[model samples]
Target: MPLPLHLLAVAVFAMGTSEFMLAGLLPDIASDLGVTVGTASSLTSAFAIGMIVGAPLAAALSRHWPRRSSLFGCVVTFAAAHVVGACTTSFPVLFAARVVAALANAGFLAVALTVAATLVAPDKKGRALAVLLAGTTLATVAGVPGGSLLGTLLSWRATFWAVAALCLPAALGILRGIPSGRTEEQAAGGPALRTELAQLARPGLLHVMLLGTLVNAATFAGFTFLAPVVTDVAGLSDTWIPVCLVLFGAGAFAGVTVAGRLADRHPGRVLAVGGPAALVGWCALAALAHEPVALLTLVCVQGALSFALGGTLITRVLYEASAAPVMAGSYATAALNTGAATGPLLAAATLTTGAGKLGPLWTSGALLAIALLVSLAAVRGRARRRQPLPPSEVGTPGAR
Candidate 1:
């Protein structure tokens, strides 16, 4: 028996809400904790660091555990950490809780992706992943904004409690829904840890991971500073920022849906189209930041392109790393998180150089252009090897 895909989506929703909601509540949290906003912002960095460190650790430690049990433990720990965060008044204690939650988040996401791939037919892997990631997309659209509103209406603590409460249904669903067995490959005595590591070290797989990292870095470079872009550059009032965010989220949701349908049939084509679209979108955003209509349109297009590229990248990685999908999934997660952490730093540095509000847009456009070139090189390299790619990887439907 297989677990219901919706259950996994629900679990991802809870985890993603916790991961992203902090951005919306930073000011409220800072005021309540008597810390400066800059200091409070470190909490987000801490969560990203925890994810980078935790994904590999979880993959290593839980490789031999039953998949369902491992997922259950992570969800419970994540919920408990949120409870602690909600109750804590001290900044350090809340930060610690954030780190713990992020560790659990990393573990759960890695396992969930592996399980999703296993549950579906090879041809459906891209669609399965798209459904799973839609949860995160919803988190950005609904959870983050709702959490922000909850904090505004009550207190930031209430928002934490609300997130913790969300975990209960997700945990119960996992416990009851996931079938009792090792994952598909693991049940057949999957490759040893050393073997998986060696597979992960392949040059082709490394190129794919690098592409994933670069795509995320480009997306986040502009996204991290979107509020400032909206107000300072687009000349929009602060009140319109949330509306802009919702628009971005809507575009992401739509992009993921379309990518899910097309990726299995055209993985390479998806990347080829999305990478250039994102580059154009970012450059347009840089030049037209002061034009409210153009700025809004570019923002939505940039959001769509980012997720479209991401979906294709994940499908490609899974195809290339078929021998040890679980561990490979963790590597992908860690790489993306590393890029997420790096992007904000890059944007901040650009701003410091007096590049003005357009700094992040131009910076992200440059990164996307480089990523596009790398992607093109990777496609050509894979073609030159003449190795038989999976049907999905070859960008043909039913090639197998």
Candidate 2:
């Protein structure tokens, strides 16, 4: 709705395209680098690891910096990493590049959440965040597919080069368009990192983190092995891989849009509905892997349910924390990264144990069940806290 929002959107679009392209281009990259596909896949893993380690580290390190400047710094770092990745011939060098880019991407996203939240009214926070998040969704629906096609037609390295080029204009747009508002100045001193840590000591917040962990694990369980499942297990062709991913993306886009709107209206209901749907989808995905049409149908359902919960859950965590918005954003993102890292590792372990296509889906279903329980617990905990409050006070709310 605002110019700053558009700037943030553009930045997110470019960054998301850069990050997801690696997955689509993994085959080309691995072949070129003379490495195994699993080895090449580690670049994605490394990036997530970096984000888990980077969110708080960047937030703490840049405690006093202006939010706009911090965003700028992140883009600069991202651009540099992309440049390295594009030019480097060695797999190790490219892996390092991805790690650097991931750290910067996490920092930028953390700051952007705070910045976007400040730009809109309290009532519009979920919608505003939805707009910001749309960039990433669109990348999945559009950018990743395009980059993959380009990589298939040309070179994987070219995709990285294109992303690097995008960052230059994105940085310039941030400098010229996005307002360096005064909120950053006021927000700088709200709470020390230690105070934020103490607040996370609250059981509610801790459970939220655990919920994030489980939900993400559930997502990765099916997703990490999606390519192989669709190809080898389902007997689909490799040429159709992007098509399947785009189908998932279409589902993700719809899910995110619905979640954002519903969160703006009734986040609690969305949360309530999400878990059961996700659990069902996970089970369905596992069961339908051998049936081509059923597999695609189930994959779309699973993708929609899994990602739709993202905004709702993140917004819930931010509101519950209510300590420091920026800090909360950082912490929430870290929790997400933690789950991301865990999910793939768990899936890998299952695959190693001869579970094949079924392992990830079963593991994900279990994790979703766990997340569902935690979410119900959170709802119950909130209800218990609100029991003593006045009706007028109890109905009021905030979105991170």
Candidate 3:
């Protein structure tokens, strides 16, 4: 990856740690705030909700700002939110901080995607995005677990403070690495804001975005409950949760690396294989939830399958939304975050119904099944659109 892309990835790493680290900290948060763990989980929902609402709004609001300034401002806000989170005693304040941090994260991602594409050759945009997203994978492997350890060794507030501190250098990296001007996407964004908004509503782009959303929903539905599932269903020790997380993260890193290499050239091939495989992986997860050996293995397998499929679908979003490059990142961010919000909330509801850990696994499998069907439909639609008409139908009135 280029230095600029690497810097953006580093910034993403800083941001993603806060996003994923909450899963590990939820128990401590519940303990500290005198709330049930279930209630504390709302913090996870709050952040996703922020990203859901923020992606498009931030993209539109910052559309006219210099790319570097927009990115720098977002990171700075993200840092400030963490500072507030660390200092707050009230659950409501902490919850509000999660939303603020997520808004910043969403804005940075929205701008980062456009900037990343501009930093690389047109043909390499997929890889560029993969590299940027790889930051999240790295965060999963390192930062998430690192935060968990920090929360364990010191305090949950320590995790917040650490994330706040990390953002300082990340803000500087944005100012140093990202170019200071109207980006290429901004230049292509016609004077009318409606032009960019129209892309979100475009059926083809929406289809791809929907596919991305479903895959992510399936992935997160299982992931959000990992700590509990490892301990309760698999009968593993709390110490095992971080190890499981590392395995899943390792798998995610590998999945995204392969997607970066193949998605641009073989998007259909990847969709054909990845969708069904991800669905099957979820099925295995549900079936093996009680078997520690099998459950742990499935975690890694599902992670790889989910991210590979999800990453490709997102790459398709960029391809489909190419006409509105400035808004493409917003579309992707909104898609992923929508799933992030929906999946865990649904899983949490299932848990409240006394479905046990199997509920989340089933929830994940069901979402993946829907994703598979959507993927198949999308691939078929793309194929039909690309297929040539017969000679007799060529230039015919009916064909037209």
Candidate 4:
């Protein structure tokens, strides 16, 4: 909606690209750095670990700092890390760079969500978050695929160079686009850091975030291993991998778009419908893996439902923490990264069983079921809170 929001999305696009761009470049990175593919894949894990750590830590540390400065500095650090990765031949150096880059990515996202939320009106908070998060889903459609193509045409190192260079314009835009003044959250004269952190520990906020985490875990569990499902179970060619990716990404784009429209007004109804629909999608995904047409169709549906649910959950976290906005985005970021890191690990475990290529989909179903239970509990909790006190309890000062 606002120019500054678009500018933030521009930066998010670059950051999101770098965050997952390596999925396609891992082999090349391994070959160039003289390591096994397994070893090179650790870069992804390293980045996830860094993000899990950086989100809350960076947000808390920089809670008092200027938003523009935090945003700009994080972007610069991220770009610099990519430069190091592009130039370095040593595996350890590249690994370290990945971690640093993730730290920057996490910090930038945490603050950016807060800044985006603050910039818009209360009613449009969901729309604002969706606009920003669209960059990420768009990255799946364009940035990751583009990076892979760049690596194929040139070198994997060249792709890193491209990612690094992409941030330059974004950094400059952030410098000029975002304001340097105190936001409403800051102007509230928030409590001390210790108190702010304690506020985040409130059960309502934590319940919302936990729901977000479980939903994300389910989403990632299916997604991380989707390529194998396409090739092995769906009986598709390697050429079809990117095509399926495009379809899924397109669905994700559509999902967030729809989510942005209705999330604020109907979060419960949306989640109630979408959550079960997603569970069904996961079940069908596993059962239909052998049927390519069915499999591919489900892929698109899953993407849309997954991201729609995700966007809503993130917005709910913001709503839950509205009274104590400090570090709210950080907690959301932590939940996000926690899900990102754990989903694959859990799915991998399922894969090792007799389930074979369909394991991840099953894992997704199980995780979604858990998330839905949490959602149901949260709904009940809110209903309980909203109920008027009994007449006797209200009348007596210390009713038994």
Best by TM-score: 3
Report every candidate's CA lDDT.
0.80, 0.78, 0.85, 0.83
* Model 3: lDDT to the true structure: 0.85
Per residue, candidate 4 scores C-alpha lDDT tens digits across 125-214 of 999999998888888788867876778678888889988998999999999999987676677767667776776668878887888888
By summed lDDT, which 10 consecutive residues of candidate 3 come out lowest? 184-193
Clashing pairs in 1: none
TM of each candidate vs. truth: 0.88, 0.89, 0.93, 0.89
- Pairs clashing within candidate 2: none
Q: Count clashing residue pairs per candidate.
A: 0, 0, 0, 0
TM-score for predicted model 1 compared with the true structure: 0.88
lDDT of 2 by residue, 160-213 (tens): 888888888889988987766546535556677787767778886787677877
lDDT of 3 by residue, 48-86 (tens): 889988888888888789988999999999999999999
Off by over 4 Å in 2: 184-188, 377-400
User: For candidate 1, lDDT tens digit of each residue in 280-365?
Assistant: 89998999989999888887787788888887787777787888766877887887777776765676567756777678788899
Q: What are the C-alpha RMSDs, in order, of all predicted structures?
A: 6.3, 5.6, 2.6, 3.1
